[model samples]
Target: MAKGAAKGPTVASLKKVTPENLASLGVERLAELLVSVAETRPDLKRRLRMELAANQGPEHLAAEIDKRLGSLQTSRGHVVWRQKPAFVRDLDALRRLIAERLTELDPAAALDRLWLFLQTAQPVARRFRDRDRDGAVAAAYVRAAADLGRLLADQDPHLAANALIDAVAADPEPWAVWAPETLRESSAAMAAVALKAARGRLGGAAPSLAVVRALAQAAGDLDALRGSWSLQALANPSVAAALAPQFLAAGRVGEAGEILRAAAPQPTGPSGRLPPPDFAWESAWIDYLDQAGETAAAQDVRWASFERTLDVDRARSFTTRLADFDDVEAEGRAFAYAAAHTDFERGLGFLMAWPALAEAARMIAARPDDLDIDPAQAELWAAQLRRRFPAAAHRLLRAAAAAAFRRREFKLCDRLTEEADTIIL
Candidate 1:
């Protein structure tokens, strides 16, 4: 008398069938099946087209690319929100195809076409309402530029240098902010190639210094690489931060340290609030110090930064260093300090993430009776603690439920009351 399970196989189960069986059908039936499958799965059709295009020569592929590009261009007037992603995907596929063909046959032509694609497609991307799609198109353009730069780097270094320079100079405001990490990385790669070409041209007595100067000139800054617009476009912390590794690589560790120290943010005002530290620059300095066997200095910076900010990540990192040096007492103190000063939920998370459960329990128990904690979060934490420390969990839930009741958070109070009862039972 039980109700029957849903009839028919799921699409996932249907996918388990072998393609060999489908091939056994006559050509007419196979064609019919292909139509059905293509209707159901558009991505399959796209993949098949890409595979066919890959097998064709550059001339044929170029024609196909033109056709796809034309379709996208002409469809701009009538594009709906739902159809925008499809159009962007089609354009991306065509651009990639064009780049591949042109790179293989003519690197110079590839660079020209990619530059044109960036100019044309970026406007179209900007028009789309979906920010993610715009970012995707932007990333594709940057990647294509990188590919073109690599292609032209060896064949015609000047052209490659110009192409890369043009790419970095392109306006990257909204897209860069939306997708800074990837866009910054792609821009950096292009800049690196341009710098390499400049270095090749400016071989001198002090090759490293000359190369840095040449990089400055190529960036259109006659002064030096420091504070160049081109270097700013690369989104590194500062010119000194960017150049430190290059100096270190050239066996100038002392110069690298000087550069980093000069760039380091100074403490400000009587409150001793330092300027918001550039994490990347700080990390680089710490790494360089560690590499130079200045373990104590590195640890000192790490601990000071953590104490000033109560930043959980810095605390963890400092703890890791302490553990490496077999300093368990310092590590425990670090965790205790973080737990004491950090916000209740964040402190709980930091302690739990560190798997310092005993410390977490102690911190919760020691919290002032009048202090407010989010009732829902307290209940959740109590649930997590019940498995390991039942007594502490029960006390926490009861306290949170009382706080919730006092605040007229009846729903949370009821939930916590039930949870506390369950734990006690």
Candidate 2:
């Protein structure tokens, strides 16, 4: 009240104006602040307008949403990489407004608008998805798709099923992946409707097989799922491998075996004789043999896969299944096989990961020139082996340093050389 007294800090300057603090400023002041803030922040302004529309009732909110959705639908501007962040943020905000806010007031309108948004957004999303290394834009669409699924989950099963059928039938890419969860929450009758609709879309380039398999799995109708796969489809090793597990789980070992056996290897290479090995089919067959009580056959498949592929997982699976002393013997054989493997790098990697450090050391000493050591892997190996296999660790670190030096990475090379020096015997 004194004229010469220093003025106290105003309320805006006294503390950070968080939501709680801003609320204390009272509705009138807050409204003015919002308007001032909205003058510069378009996103916040649009959100406030939507909230205001919502106050007028669902119809008014629905009209605002329709205008927004129509604008998005007509948007033709390509969202370049630099524009992606704002594009994703705005799209996600619209998705949340429809899903979280509008749905509560008018569920049917929300669902319809969401479908419209998805249909409008998917093509643009798919265009950018390939170039989206971090997948921010694609993730926004996934969240939208998942929101659609959750909304469908709340609808009556019959109506929800029809909505799902129509969604996938229109654009199946991202939607089909989320449909199974909705289908899972639906009644068997709903699942049947979904499966039947998917069946009609089969071989029509709609990724309908995925939908069929997903629906059948949800409905527990393995028969329809099996019949859904045409012979052409079954010939693809992955398809056969996929169907085999369901049959095996049902104790139809013969059918499982028959399908796996019927699966043709995907031909590759100049001669076409060297078909890329179907590791999935091999694993499936091992599983089928094991479940059928053919332990010996399963073990043979496991060992063969290990030998042919040098896949350490198959080696582990084989050795784990062997009886006490037999495992030790099998492991010895595996070690020898790895040491003599045609792919020197793979063989050495196998030995190193197996913690056969002595063997790895011997391999390094024997074929140092053949080893292509990753610097990080070499660092880990050196740290692990320095106390015991100093010579091998020295060799690995020097090799990695040499690799780095050749690539003109002087800093990494110097760092590695220093590390290697500490291991000199």
Off by over 4 Å in 1: 1-28, 33-57, 71-78, 99-116, 126-134, 146-156, 162-193, 196-251, 267-281, 291-294, 316-326, 339-347, 368-371, 375-380, 399-409
RMSD of each: 7.9, 6.4
Model number with the top TM-score: 2
lDDT of 2 by residue, 148-238 (tens): 7677766776687777877787767665566665555456666776677666654545476677777888778888888877888888788
Task: Extract clashing residue pairs from model 1.
Answer: none
Query: In angstroms, how far off is 132's CA in candidate 2?
Result: 6.3
lDDT of each: 0.62, 0.80
**lDDT per residue (tens digit) for residues 146-240 in model 1:** 55545554454455555544443454332222222222323344445566554444333333343344445334333345433243333445666
Question: Which portions of model 2 miss their true places by more than 4 Å?
Answer: 1-36, 55-57, 122-135, 171-189, 198-203, 264-276, 366-369, 403-412
Top lDDT prediction, candidate number: 2
Error of 2 at 20 (Å): 7.5
Q: Cα lDDT of model 1 overall?
A: 0.62
**Model 1 residue 398 lDDT?**
86
